[model samples]
Target: MIANTVRQFARVQQRRTLSTSVPSGVRYGKSFGATWLGDKGAWPVIGIIGGALVFCGSFISNKIMFHPDVRITPSKRNADIRDWR
Candidate 1:
């Protein structure tokens, strides 16, 4: 009798999966909250990688821009300027 009661309780606790189709990106409230990684998810990783790439690209660009023969100061504004000579 005790085994039968335990089996009944176990059956009550079992979850059923619905056969209905689920729409893409349709996040139920609790499921959405449960899936959250508290801001440590893909966005942060992409931001960090993108930031590093941008910083490195800017550094290389500045180096190329400021090369010795590539003077772009106001003194070299144009060939017709007196100071440019």
Candidate 2:
């Protein structure tokens, strides 16, 4: 339909000349592109932000729930006298 006509027109334009001289014994089309974030040190900032969000969310859930004042009975596997007063 109309899509095929636009694709054919674009293909004609892609055939324009664009080249660079290659060194002797060097292979072409064997390279890839990369970003510029290498050697940068920003991991601490990212980790702090993520950890703060998780802590805030946990605090909010503990503060605002359907049964905030109710005591939850522990399951048999997790029930230990030392965990209770």
Candidate 3:
């Protein structure tokens, strides 16, 4: 029984060592942002342009939709609410 257990353990250890070995011709190296983004330097410019567009869009939309002078209807009922301002 002891000999059978030793043989089984030796076979398992051998299989594990063989499976963990790196395959031939496989190269590992450091990764850079350029690998995914095409150009690492352009990220900052892209971020700035995107941020500016978002800010300007929100600002314009707010000014058009929520300005105090702009009312839902240009009638006396709407004008009566101006006292709340």
Candidate 4:
């Protein structure tokens, strides 16, 4: 009895697989995210994107806070107004 039930479930699963067809571009793409990796199977891609965003945000914040490019001091704008020195 159990064997028959298991076989019937297997047949149903096989039928489902045969009936549904993945899109060509989603199935076959250059990157993992472009393909099924992020198409039907998108959990991994979501995790990757989330982690990358967090890391990138922290990196950018650190750069902005710790390393400032322009140091605005009290320098006169028209101190050296001579033309072609």
Candidate 2, residue 54: lDDT: 100
List, residue by residue over 1-85, the lDDT tens digit for candidate 3.
Answer: 9999999999999999999999864545625544436667878888999899999999989986878766655563446558534
RMSD of each: 13.6, 11.6, 10.5, 14.7
TM-score on alpha carbons, each prediction: 0.33, 0.32, 0.40, 0.35
Compare the candidates by TM-score and give the number of the best one. 3
67: Cα error in model 4, Å: 1.3
lDDT of 2 by residue, 1-85 (tens): 8999999878776664333434464545554222222314655666788899999999878765534343454453355443333
Error of 2 at 13 (Å): 40
Candidate 1 achieves a global lDDT of 0.66
- Greater-TM-score candidate between 2 and 4: 4
CA lDDT, candidate 2, residue 18: 30
What tens digits encode model 1's per-residue C-alpha lDDT throughout 15-83?
332334575756666564455544457667768888999999998888768655455776665555344
* Model 4 vs. true fold: TM: 0.35
Clashing residue pairs in candidate 1 (N, C-alpha, C atoms within 3 angstroms): none
Residue lDDT tens for model 4, 1-85: 9999999999999999977967555543377545545465687778899999999999988876555452233353244552322
lDDT values for all models: 0.66, 0.57, 0.76, 0.67
- Cα misplacement distance, residue 20 of candidate 2 (Å): 35
Query: Candidate 1: misplaced stretches above 4 Å?
Result: 1-40, 69-85
The better candidate by lDDT, 2 or 4, is 4
Model 3 segments more than 4 A misplaced: 1-36, 70-85
User: Of the pair 3 and 4, which is ahead by lDDT?
Assistant: 3
